[model samples]
Target: MPMSSKTMNMLEGLVKDSSFKWLLGKQSSFDEEIEEMGRSPSAGTNWIPELSPVANVVVRRCSKILGVSANDLRDSFKQEASESLKQPSLFARNFLEYCCFRALSLSVGVTGHLADKKFRRLTFDMMVVWEVPAVASQALLSVEEDATVSLEAFSRIAPAVPIIADVIICENLFGMLTSSTGGRLQFSVYDKYLCGLERAIKKMRTQSESSLLSGVRPKKEKILEIDGTVTTQPVLEHVGMSTWPGRLILTDHSLYFEALKVVSYDKPKRYDLSEDLKQIVKPELTGPWGTRLFDKAVSYKSISLTSGDGVPGA
Candidate 1:
């Protein structure tokens, strides 16, 4: 649905007033921070406090429409509905104008169901992506987590709605997955970098008795970049969790397993996205918004376990 100026204004007021800061503590304050930034030195400005007005608008509208009210909208809705239903010939006027509260409740359900069907294809498209992109690219947006916020917004509006999402992906894009060997090797590489052996060994490798290479890929090693391959990846049937559109709208561990396979690693029963580098690699994974779904992948050097990141997940 198209947004109304009134709705935007309402959100602007909330942004200006520090509303909904708890949902995204720092993120919710972006408007104020930007306003303050405009008056200060430009260097090292805080960005968490400066979200795009468009994102704020989107969040505001979604929250309202999905019933994730940060204000008195719900009571207002009930009052307005009650007052309006008392009018003459409302039910006979048609579905929208139907008088009974039950009718209105059912209408919300039907509307949500209808919307799920309309966007079901895109949901499937996003779900097909096996892993989050190293970064978002046109071919494979790094789990394409944007769908999570939007879908969560949808659920807020229609809590009963099912939002089916498949793991989305293509060839040219997939997240980095280091093997146990890779981890072991990075330590060797880092140790070399820390000392004088890195450059010495490189020179030696080029002009030595044997034409062999040793050590590991850097934690910052780039994944596929040359080929612009865009194709569908096979889907996994299930995981520890069942298919709950509303739940997957927040996070899908099944897809994470598929992504683990993308890096040729097995999915840990639990994963952690915030762990620091273990043997060599640092921990970091895409959030659902970027993955186009809800799920935050966390990892550490020796292990990974997925847990609550405050954005619903298995």
Candidate 2:
């Protein structure tokens, strides 16, 4: 179901609040305090009230947005008592992550909402919170403060792009994130990627309507990855004793390799990845004349293709 207008207004108000902004910026943790509550004599004591003032407000707001009781949301943070006692700080941090992840997942379903400045900033703040969920004695600093996120955090909140183009695999996502932000994803870089991905999908859709490959690509096929740059890194296809430099493209259903000619690319040869061909893909070495001198290639063998034929290694 779509989020109600009232809920959107509530979220906007929450984000605009000075205290909430301070909470996100500071990332204060009350883990030690919460842990002390766990040791109270009263059994089943409500621990939500013991959270830091801003955190308490955030949790209550999230509960309201999720249409659940505040206690219900608190109970969702399940951990063995022994474990929580041993690593209370870690447990507290993880609980914060859980709440933010659930809330953001619901709010970011619409791509158009991502264009909203408040929504964008809120999403980035969530990423910042994930990095350091609690107050620390010693601060952890990056090139950009509260601006970088790990791959795991990015995957949790990133809007699904398969609706636009192809299913994003972890390997491809990692490559894009690392290439742009040098292993830690920055908000600006991430936002740019989302905008570029939307434009690329639209452009590809228009091109596919009249392109020669329209007859070749199967119905519902979405391009996953394409590498053909000669200036940076050229893709090379190894077949038996001959090595052919080419452009390689992977889709949901198949792999296409178009060998590079003098100035133009040869007709793309399809390698079916979705077929029941008992395909095997693994890392292998490649060099000149079938010499395995460099461990920088992947070998692909299927019932249809000869064992000597290998996919592009770049």
RMSD of each: 24.2, 11.4
Model 1, range 106-220, lDDT digits (tens) per residue? 4335433323332332222222221121112222211222222223222222222222111232111111111333221122322222234234334433431101111222234
Residues 133-228 of candidate 2 have per-residue lDDT tens digits of: 443411431113335777765665453323322335644775666794579877677667666766665555543222435568877998866666
Instruction: Name the candidate that leads on TM-score.
Output: 2
How does model 1 fare in lDDT?
A: 0.27
Highest lDDT model number: 2
TM-score of 1: 0.16
Model 2: ten consecutive residues of lowest lDDT? 137-146
Per-model clash counts, in order, read 44, 1
Worst 10 residues of 1 by lDDT: 246-255
* Cα lDDT computed for each candidate against the true fold: 0.27, 0.56
Candidate 2 displacement at residue 304 in angstroms? 1.9
